[model samples]
Target: MNSPLSPIDFEDKRLKIKFKLEKRLQKELQALTKDPPTGVKVDAESIYRNLSEWIVDIDGAPESLYEGEKFKLMFKFGSRYPFDSPQVMFIGENIPLHPHVYSNGHICLSILTDDWSPALSVQSVCLSVVSMLSSCKEKKRPPDNSFYVKTCSKNPKKTRWWYHGK
Candidate 1:
């Protein structure tokens, strides 16, 4: 008969998953460097050092409400990436003033939550964000931005976002 796995065994398994994730992320980083998606710039070194985190720069699309503005997105990945979605949020001082983007940088995008799919890649997410920004008709923060910012967790992923509208 076999005994139950110990806590140490779980830790070891987690470490192995992390290692695999690192390698996969490295490949993604290399691909991004070679042919980056439009409006997105990623720091390969930062990703290499810490495969679980990435900081990306996004240029606002021309003629869009956010034209001439720049924003930074922080992505935090777990060992179950590809199977799980990355915790992405706008960082830095210039968070976009969009109905879907909160004052605190928590983006209420369905793709990042309930609609997430393992098939989605970092580049795809960037494009989706760009598309979301481009489709906005007005430049304004969410109605409950202040309240959400004050009460939400530091990690946007922890919040249960209620996505509504287009």
Candidate 2:
């Protein structure tokens, strides 16, 4: 039998990256389901290498403005992955606008960028987002949240999100 570790005949780097990401995602999913967060349900999962997108469905919040709501969020992982942070956003048309979330569903969180470390996992990110949402007291959004969509760009591997508080 051929060794499973042998590389497959693929020329596209993106394909190779996708394979790795999918493999990691599968393991992560298994582990997550084996020990899911309290009151949270995962509805779907998919990977898109070309677009660098990872789609996840979450049903209900343990705390926050989104309680009792089912939402779909997108995470865009960069080449650096664990070393750097992934870009997370909300999808769909009917999401409630929050201070930390932009109009296009992009989220502004410290851990997803500046505070990211390899020690963190996908579960941590999800939990953090949940906690952030849960803590919201006002239904309105941030003052300058609209500018993020215009200023933010997809991570290109080298860019690092600033972690220090302003």
Candidate 3:
């Protein structure tokens, strides 16, 4: 069991998940800070609750529909963080909907949902979301966005997604 005062050991499932996330986060920070993706910038990041949640600030892709946007996204690490999947979403105002995004900022991606696996890391999720934004050429949300927002079933991990097509 984890003591109140001592840091949880890596062997502990939750603590282990947290440690791996932190390590991945550090590596991503180093890579992005040195060579960030086009139109995406990292503003801030943090890990808390024995690594149960990670908060990251990102400047949206420039000149795109999401350009000039600042978003705060939260990644909720479950007990089965890697084995299962981390829940992620935008947690601030101005979370717009796109073909791949629900109004709630929950994303639609295989890696973060059905296709997720232990081999993937936090970096992949971030890149995928960013790529998702960059892929948007319409500069607008989907046509049936409102309906999808209301009726879409969340991923098995309880993530909401705006599926663009059947």
Which of the predicted structures, 1 or 3, would earn the higher TM-score when compared with the native? 1
Worst 10 residues of 2 by lDDT: 155-164
lDDT of 1 by residue, 1-166 (tens): 9989899998999899887878778888888889998788998877788778899999999989888799999999976897899999999999999999998888999999889998887888988999999999989998888999889999877888787767
Ranked by lDDT from best down, the candidates are 1, 2, 3
The CA lDDT at 87 in model 1 is 94
lDDT of 3 by residue, 1-166 (tens): 8556434443576676667767765665567657765544554443423345666666677666677777776777665656777887767886755666667566667777777888776667776777677678765565666876687555335644434443
Cα displacement (Å) at residue 27, model 1: 1.6
Worst 10-residue lDDT window for candidate 1 reads 157-166
User: Would you estimate the TM-scores of all the predictions?
Assistant: 0.89, 0.69, 0.64
- List lDDT for all candidates, in order: 0.88, 0.65, 0.65
Estimate the overall C-alpha local distance difference test score of candidate 1: 0.88
Which candidate achieves the best lDDT against the true structure?
1
Between candidates 1 and 2, the one scoring higher on lDDT is 1
Error of 3 at 112 (Å): 1.1
